[model samples]
Target: MCAVAAVLLASGASAQSGWGGGAFFNADVFRADREAWHEERLVVQRRFSAGAASLEGGTVSRNGFTDPFVATDLYARAGTRGYGNLRAQWAPEASGVPRLDLLAEAYAVVGTGWEASLGARHIVTASSAATLGTGSVAKYVGNWTVRARGVATLDETIAVSTSLSARYLFDGVGGLTAPFAEVTVGRGREPVVAAGGLEIRPSWVVNGRVQREVRSGFGVSASLGYIWDDSLTRWTGGLGVTGRF
Candidate 1:
């Protein structure tokens, strides 16, 4: 994806102002079989007065091969109290990764403390394709934010999941520190792997994450998660760093 990165940087340089970007890396290791998956991404974005555009290139390593992907995201204000986001991704020669993915969402701000969003996602692989619909509602109270999300498959085999999360943000010395916990339930498809192949048959999941901005334009985050089902159970932990310029 080196050529993709060069193109993204060239486009970012053309932005008149409010240009910034970041890099991120994450890895997940399954406890049961000791298999690991790694992902790394570089992003560049330009923020306009009312909208933003970003391009990201990333690689996913799993099994014994790596797949490179490129994604573009666009965010814009819909009206005084609403916004929309659209994202698309392409990974041509990928088996574990989706060859084509598209997502679109619209968010509405309700009064002062509530927000709601509706979205849909379509993913295509070499063997199969699926479309999913999602909706979420979030409430902000004091320094705490609570959100509930639901997802359902739109294809023939019906699967659904619901998740609830709460996050607390603290104004620390450098910038902001946030910690969050989430719980999801129901028989649904999750983006996880088993036996070197992507599997989507998980019953429930629990996740916790903490992020801290240690200095100006630099941040660190760590996460722990557990996935459970009838035949599989595994724990995953990951650490990430991000820098903005």
Candidate 2:
């Protein structure tokens, strides 16, 4: 993966300065039965600008799951004078399960110290899957910053749930862009059914994550997660390395 990222960086730096790609591997170790699985991901991103409009596309592939999947996302943003910026994204998945997601967002810079955003998402999935709704708001404090984001899921098969995330960016700390920590908690139902027509109860889960920026285009992250259910009292740990051109 490192080799591929290096090659892409070199090529992009020498050419039209628009194409770049990278690869990643994520391994999770289950604390209950000592089961471990690894997932590999590949990402490619491109950006273009015309007048006051900009377009970007990122594609990702996830392997090592029971069923591998590919996802592609395209985003377009048009800049305005003072009010805000308009952004839209189209994300489609090809996992033999057929899913499409559309997201639209509007962000406005207020005064010189505050920004607010409102967004909506619509998802369609095969087999009557759950639908997701998301919203976010952010504010800048001094030069260093903090932001909060939230997401919700609603459907019959799964109970409603909400998650909140917070982040802070440390400025000039060893020339890092942002070093942050986040915590998320939510509740949802499990999709387990028995032949006797029994349904599993809902459960609450909590997770904490921490990440640091190592250099200009390289970083490392680790996360620990836990579930409160008796049968699902599993702790998971992960480590990841990322680089960009």
Candidate 3:
């Protein structure tokens, strides 16, 4: 889910400045058939007093096809305690990727150190189109954060999935370091393996990552994940670098 990645990027260490830029690479390997997929992206962002905007461009290789795509996102504050994000993406003439995707969400601070959000997503591919709904709630306790999220597809057959995650931010002399873990279960589609010509299947995933501010305005992160679905098992890994000025 690109939405999940957007949320994380908005809250992670890279979001601490007026301007930021980053690059990321990720790979997934399916054990059942020895197939591999890869993705890379570059991001540029600017934060204003009441809002932020970002642009991303990337290439994805999957199922023996490669395509380039571009996406843009806007984040604005609704009030002192409410905010929202809107994103759109396009990949022209892509067969194994979404031809167009859009997401919109509104979030609010529900209570002290608590937040919640509701959102919707639409994806169109060369052969089919699907719409999905999403929601999430998060809590911040001292230097730790926990969140729960759910996604449901509203196609002919309904498929739902839930994910839970926790992160601890370590503050030190140079910068901040965060360690994160997440688990998801259900039949919902995961973001890792983009929904191209793939069908919805029951799946579970475990993911772990560490993000660190290497210097005052620079950061790096690494992630590893394992997924098991009805037909295949997959291993995924990712690396990212970001900078702010």
Candidate 4:
């Protein structure tokens, strides 16, 4: 939950990868974790025709929590008929062993507009326990694209959740302007979360969302968005930058 930004790495036939900077704000999450609840990150990522990998690290800070912590995460995705991803995070410790978490998932396209995935999340702590998770996603792409996803974990750590999203891309703008929105519901203790945002491309990059352009080679892009959940009445916004080189 440190960063769910660009959660879906590849969709359809195209892939997106580059170097970027990002920030995430978890409202009242400070109360839950007690330390390093808010994070700022610098990331380097690469996405090939059939696979993707990324490395990110930064400072996780929160008040009255554990000390300001330095954390790094590694993510990988690959496959053909289906795809798989591995995500790992580590919070370095000065004295003892590092605090770490790992998650891995495999997904495959089932039909014309459907993909199913199964995953597990592990907390490598003293007890070293793991949570089994499963999810399915469906997507339709054309003039307007739409997607829906549902996920649930065996353990309560990651509650059962579902989300529906849609977006319109401006063909006239070189597919640069995209307006999108998503609604998410959490089954257990977590509240429903929603977000509405726009992606605008200036130069060769998009400043609001993640989508590969019609034509690709190299470009610079930026993204900004606001999120709202039942738990936080106030809107929380985030910013990100990506450049291909």
Candidate 5:
């Protein structure tokens, strides 16, 4: 396989993956209860063979809800032993009431295409918390990918919720494209919402996504991303325009 083909194969055809240290921007818009809410997240990250460090900033605002707030997240991760990995994340308090949150998680890669993860969450301002931990599992079954995650919050106002999602990958559909669908059911305000989307990688180093969100209301989102690598040589720029990393 060529170098570019190797990268794409290692990526498992995921469009949102970055090769190494790079910058990525993502934005999300939500509509619920006849109100509009939006969030924009910017991330700068560095990834190595054994671990990674990432810093992310997010701004969220909604009508009739709390005022617009910005939050910072610091993350660090490392590989443990024999298919085990550890990760930690810190989100500083930025809400009006100011409650910091910390989460620690571990993941184990089982078999060839199965992964199990467990997480613990803590709210710095609350003496009371949730139960022991939350668990999730993800598996890739041939061209079909499956993921299910559940979270238990310590806050009394929020209920325990779990989300299930799946995607069917079309490796030979004229281009790199996949159709995905998700459904979430819980006791929350928007008890149930159904979403469907498509992730398309029309180019070797560029990709885009478009999705529709449905619940009590409806909305849509779109994003475009790009990535390139020149790590194979620093002086390739002087050689020619068609340089390879």
Candidate 6:
């Protein structure tokens, strides 16, 4: 996790020249008998526009679930964890339309696994745009996961997005491939903004989330989720605080 974070920090410094960080917590309420988990993440990013080319990277942590076997049972256990990612962006001047943005990124769970993705961004309206990307990750021996996502912003005040991801495992331990999707709505202003999303994890889980922002460099968020496993169904929720300077 530390290595990933360092890589991200390095990417940010090498590309943009800015620094920022945030934290979040999640709780499951359905299965009150189980312990709730929390996660914290921080990032420092910089964007350098050198003739329409840019690069960025930063560190991230998810807390808990370090052991792949234990992480697989995340539906039952809770804890803290971390990961890292490196990304690059590029934009070239166009004749009459808005410039197009392209991005490529690589990520890893410290020592466990890694993934790579490529994406594109196109402005659809004055305050709205859309993004598309594809990526794959090595999860376990003979197991791999692929993800495709699309996100669109309708207005400066409201945004919506969704993604479809699939995973295949060689061993019988993992379930068959499935699709997942999510939608987010956000309202942004000078110092504060409110955002929320509903996520469906196919046969695994469903979640609802909301967050509030403060202009004083601090913010908080909360979420409630339900997990359906082979053994039982559970609910979880959590709250988190973040700051920036």
Candidate 4: Cα lDDT at 99: 51
Model 1 spans > 4 angstroms off: 1-17, 171-187, 190-200, 230-232
Q: Check candidate 5 and list the clashing pairs.
A: none
Q: Residues 1-245, candidate 3, lDDT per residue (tens digit)?
A: 44223433223222333677778899988877756988998888777667778888999888788999999988777867777989998998786678888999898888887889999988888767888899999887755668888988887778888888776656511121222333333344643224455366677788887777788877888888888875567888898887777
RMSD per model, one decimal: 6.8, 8.6, 3.8, 9.7, 15.7, 21.6
Question: Which candidate number has the best TM-score?
Answer: 3
Q: Rank the candidates by TM-score, best first.
A: 3, 1, 4, 2, 5, 6
Which of 2 and 3 is the better model by TM-score? 3
Worst ten in a row by lDDT for model 5:
232-241
Candidate 4 clash figure, as a count = 3
lDDT of 2 by residue, 1-245 (tens): 11112110110011112444444555444456644544555556553331122233333222221334444434333343122223333333333222454555555555454555556554544333334455545455533334455544444543444445443434312111124555667665533222212244566667775556697766676767776655545555555554445
The Cα error of candidate 4 at residue 93, in Å, is 3.7
Error of 3 at 137 (Å): 1.5
Instruction: Residues 125-212, candidate 1: write the lDDT tens digits.
Output: 7677778898988776755567788887777767777888775555411111122223333345654333433356756778776766
Q: What clash pairs does model 1 have?
A: none
lDDT of 4 at 90: 71
What stretches of model 2 exceed 4 Å from their correct place? 1-22, 27-38, 47-65, 80-106, 109-116, 120-126, 143-148, 154-159, 171-205, 210-216
Estimate, for each residue in 1-245, the C-alpha lDDT of model 6 and write its tens digit.
11111221111112112333344343433353544333333333222222111122222121222111000000111112222233322222222121223333433333344333333333321222444433333332233333334343333433434444443322222110111112222211111101111111223445544434455545555666665552235665655554444
TM-score of each: 0.79, 0.56, 0.86, 0.59, 0.47, 0.33
What ranges in model 6 sit over 4 Å off? 1-17, 29-33, 40-202
lDDT against the true structure, each candidate: 0.63, 0.42, 0.71, 0.42, 0.34, 0.30
Q: Is candidate 1 or candidate 2 better by lDDT?
A: 1
